[model samples]
Target chain A: MSDQEKEVTIYDIANKLNISAATVSRGLKDHPAINKNTKKKILAAAAEMGYRSNSFASNLRKKSSHIIGVIVPRLNSSFMSDVIAGIEKVVNEANYNLFISQSLESMKKEVSNAKAMFNNRVDGLMVSLAYDTSDIAHFESFINRGIPLVFFDRIYEHEKCPSIYINNYKAAYDITSHLIEQGCKRIAHISGNQLRNVYAERTRGYQQALKDNHVPFDDTLLIINDLSARAGNEAANQLLNLPVRPDGVFVANDICAISCMQAMKKQDIKIPDDIAFAGFNNDPTSCVIEPNLTTIDYKGYEMGETAARIMINHLVNNDDLQKTQSLILRSELIIRESSLKKGSKT
Target chain B: MSDQEKEVTIYDIANKLNISAATVSRGLKDHPAINKNTKKKILAAAAEMGYRSNSFASNLRKKSSHIIGVIVPRLNSSFMSDVIAGIEKVVNEANYNLFISQSLESMKKEVSNAKAMFNNRVDGLMVSLAYDTSDIAHFESFINRGIPLVFFDRIYEHEKCPSIYINNYKAAYDITSHLIEQGCKRIAHISGNQLRNVYAERTRGYQQALKDNHVPFDDTLLIINDLSARAGNEAANQLLNLPVRPDGVFVANDICAISCMQAMKKQDIKIPDDIAFAGFNNDPTSCVIEPNLTTIDYKGYEMGETAARIMINHLVNNDDLQKTQSLILRSELIIRESSLKKGSKT
Candidate 1:
């Protein structure tokens, strides 16, 4: 058969199932409104028929480039860079190129970047939403076009586009549990843009873990701020001004954690002795900091590689991948001297 | 007059000078074979006639959808990302998108990436050459046309493209003098890819400073290793085995310096007490490390911003910036507790 002859059309599946082209197309992609039995029948028929969608032809007609567009909150961030490096290595090996853009933490910029990528006609997309991005309408164009999209780190609750990320809930719970195990009664939490899913999940983790341990969660201990050195300094100021000082701290990122350490040092508060500390993402800063920060070893590179492969696999091999989309990776915790208030133990 | 009518053409200059068009063209661009007086005469005649050349037509024919291609060594590194962020901000504001590609330390991959960028027809090119990238001939495709090119950080010696960078030699000299002023008798240097101009200049600075200080320089004191954390850790092993221990240490990058510190700590060596340490690039690792690192702050963002502006100025404002090909920026040394060993008693 010719390459075009091998190309699957909605009609091929319809004919095999003795159904309309429209129904086959909708059912193969798992339309929520489709009847359960009919949807299953259509999917099974399409798979059995060995249908190969003419992605290139369809993309060309719709001005879709089969390129996966990615908009990271920022580019130079250590975590983001590692993830991207992973994605690049995977996608390049598969002959797919990612069109990456940076939102730089502004909703206006995020919207503009999304619009630009939409116009560029990427077949599918993956995103780590911006800090202040409340409404996800900017992504409506792709969702409406039946384009598959996924989110990681900072996710959006979109029905059409599934998200793939680590078990932030469990990871945070583990970190908090470890802190509590070390006998931290009054623990402070320094977080990133609360508008993000990663931070929200972490907050929930901290609260739940506190509840589980029978420790009353105090609102005063929660400091909502940007996970930056400057913000960490400001957070330190607030921590010092508090009527009752906290015994431990858990920062969302390593930079913030290290900054808080510096700020605390300025106030003559020694780390791991006056106030034990913990940070997320086993960054270079974790090792650089004295008493070496204890952190959750989040595999940023693996996340990127997996996400890139997911996009490429759907484009090249599996037609049903877009329908069943969420991928979850595991994050591990490494205890170090910073959190070891009791005799050095995990 | 029309745009072309106002343009300087070799034919018009030749007509006025009663010389060959080739001679006029060669003289305008300052070809080496052309006589100095004849070149000056052609230049004067071209100015008087307002003769236009191929630059305008060439640019119009090669419009690349206003995309600026960036080929970096790696995206995750502290310095590379800073430069990229600056480049992205400047270009995004100017309505140009960046297509970023990482070489991943492979010369073959770098070649293919260059080809892809060329085929994609990026309006202009911004590059920081890879570790082992000696032949920049892949860029000839852009130069074959009239594409505006700019290089920042890493560069080749014999290029006419506008290069925006810092005076590596002077910065290295300043830092070396600083070590000397701190009453350092023996200083060991850790270096990176020796073929690179940045490393070469730093090595040169280290040698010159020792000579000028009337201190006998030892060949055994210089260690050439890839400036990586793993490499730095291994270098520590070599340092311990040395017959004579050095009092002052200068590593090429912060990651390496911190790793060296980690290794020294394992060997029961105290930082700033047993040995003073300094590094290049004011990476966040410097701040995170205990006794905070004293090092050179290579301003990546400033370099990126300046490089973008230079290219855009040449592109939009009709300026021939190649006359001033090499642009240098300022670098500063940030001293923290690490190098504060010899105090006010000095």
Candidate 2:
């Protein structure tokens, strides 16, 4: 190896600062036994000498990598990004590094990511299930080995793994009810895969809302797809061509809702007049869209922070994960012009 | 350690399959010397026995972690999230794990993240500089150690480190010139911290375009802050209060530009008719906003893929990093209704 490739150690910093190696190590760790002035001098010497602490060696000895792994369906969405930001903030503040990867909403990729995290020996793992992640056998190793595993957002129900999520069922029910209160007799619904808890609960909520309002459930009004922008556009066309056009539309996500609304508008449909609209996940685009989208306002950042905090607490304080098997965060309905029909109460 | 806590090794898999440990290892690695049938059996046995390949041991022997580190200003933005998704795809395809961190646009946090990456012994590093990262000293260790360090988006000039970015100056120049061509004599510019090259170069481009078009550069028309949504709102108020308001506005980013446009619209200012608008980074919200914001369209996913590819090639194939000192990706001016003044040709 070249001289530049050589790893620096405590001895190198000690020699440069004319201090003992033990003192250098203590100073580097900010041990209470070390004097403040000496610690400062030691840190300066360490930086000057390019002496990086060997986390790998320490990890081997301590059996802890001080690294946490995060797996999400995708990173490009507004809600997911906010959640990641929240996770990063909490993880970084706790002096743990983050290993992040995306599943691209594929179960195959999620499985591979999980195996990689397991092989890397992450201190803890946080996951938001992929679109088609039916079986979580990939995560069984973590549970068997006593490594902390957490699920957020698109979660699965497991007795061993703790889950952090919003009450998707109630939020969906609230938004659907609001749309009904605006005098929409026939409401169309756009949702994602039924395998996932979020979409499944939302679909159930939409159905229950119609039943509670004494309105007959129409199977033709429910459109199930990937909940993508393109899908939303296609759903709009489908609804527009229906024999009996729906008076209201509720989407599982804001991105799809916005695109559907845009497509409807292009066809000369008036928002909240011809068709009232409501969506989930109060993405920034919801407010930017014309008439503003009425949606469920859930804090992805807060959900992320809560999930990370739970993992850190279990690892650091030996907190029992089972005590918080299911953590539900707060979410509310945000009514806007998109769902406000004539004579509707604000 | 408890029985469940004990790691499953190749020897255990060999014993279970009644095969030699050497053959088991070869089969597990899919070595050509092993028969296909044996390889399949070995893989099944390994999976059933919960045997995970010891990456740490292999990394020690080869002095390669098969890990890459990425640091960015923040992850909550549409562009950054797209970049991360792109990077994740490429890195995962190469069978290399990723260590991702956010600077929160703080130089202090950036320095610490760098140290953590160094300590973790990543094979290579990619960075998008923070808002206040004035000096490049923190990256010296990577350069000195011959570890490939690449910068994308927000970059710094360094002889050793290569960079991948779009032509910020030219893009800004083109957008400003477009605004001028729309019959705006006095255009306002909203930018972020000047310490960042992305913002500084943009400011220069805006000024140069004004000079070339015979539009006198007014210092009073320029607003520099964090370029946040709130800051954009404040900038709108300040510009609205000016004795002679700018006929056009060009913001460095879409989020800020959208918020500014909304603020002005609240004050009864008509877009394009009253103040033509152009913003950079074609964020999803840009199109969702009223009138559709005219901005620069650059593919963050492509930039991310390019950066990750460069690092992977240098690490895996021993490709020369110096051969590609600065790689400039493509960007285009997207003309939208917001910047289309009356009688202006599309």
DockQ per candidate: 0.14, 0.75
Per-residue alpha-carbon lDDT of candidate 1 for residues B125-171, written as tens digits (9 for 90 to 100)? 88888888878877765665556778888876545688877887877
Tens-digit per-residue lDDT, A117-230, candidate 1: 755556678899889999887787566555667787788877666677888778889999988999888899988777788998888898899999988899999998888889
Q: Which clashing pairs does model 1 show? A: B7-B51, B7-B52, B8-B51, B8-B52, B8-B53, B9-B51, B9-B52
lDDT of 2 by residue, A185-265 (tens): 999999999999999999999999899989888999999999999999999999999999999999999999999999999
Q: How well does model 1 score by local distance difference test? A: 0.78
- Off-target runs (Cα >4 Å) in candidate 1 are A1-66, A343-346, B1-62, B343-346
Clashes of 2: 0
- How high is the CA lDDT of each candidate model? 0.78, 0.92
TM-score of each: 0.80, 0.96
For candidate 2, give the lDDT of residue B153. Answer: 92
lDDT of 2 by residue, B1-346 (tens): 6687677888898888898999998897789999999999999887777777888667856878888999999999999999999999999899898989999999998999998898888999999999999898888877877788999999998888889998889999999999999999999999998887889889999999999999999999999989899999999999999999999999999999999999999999999999999999999999999999999999999999999999999988989999999999999999999999987865
Error of 2 at B59 (Å): 1.0
- For candidate 1 chain A, the 10 contiguous residues with the lowest summed lDDT are A50-59
Instruction: Return the clash pairs for model 2, or none.
Output: none
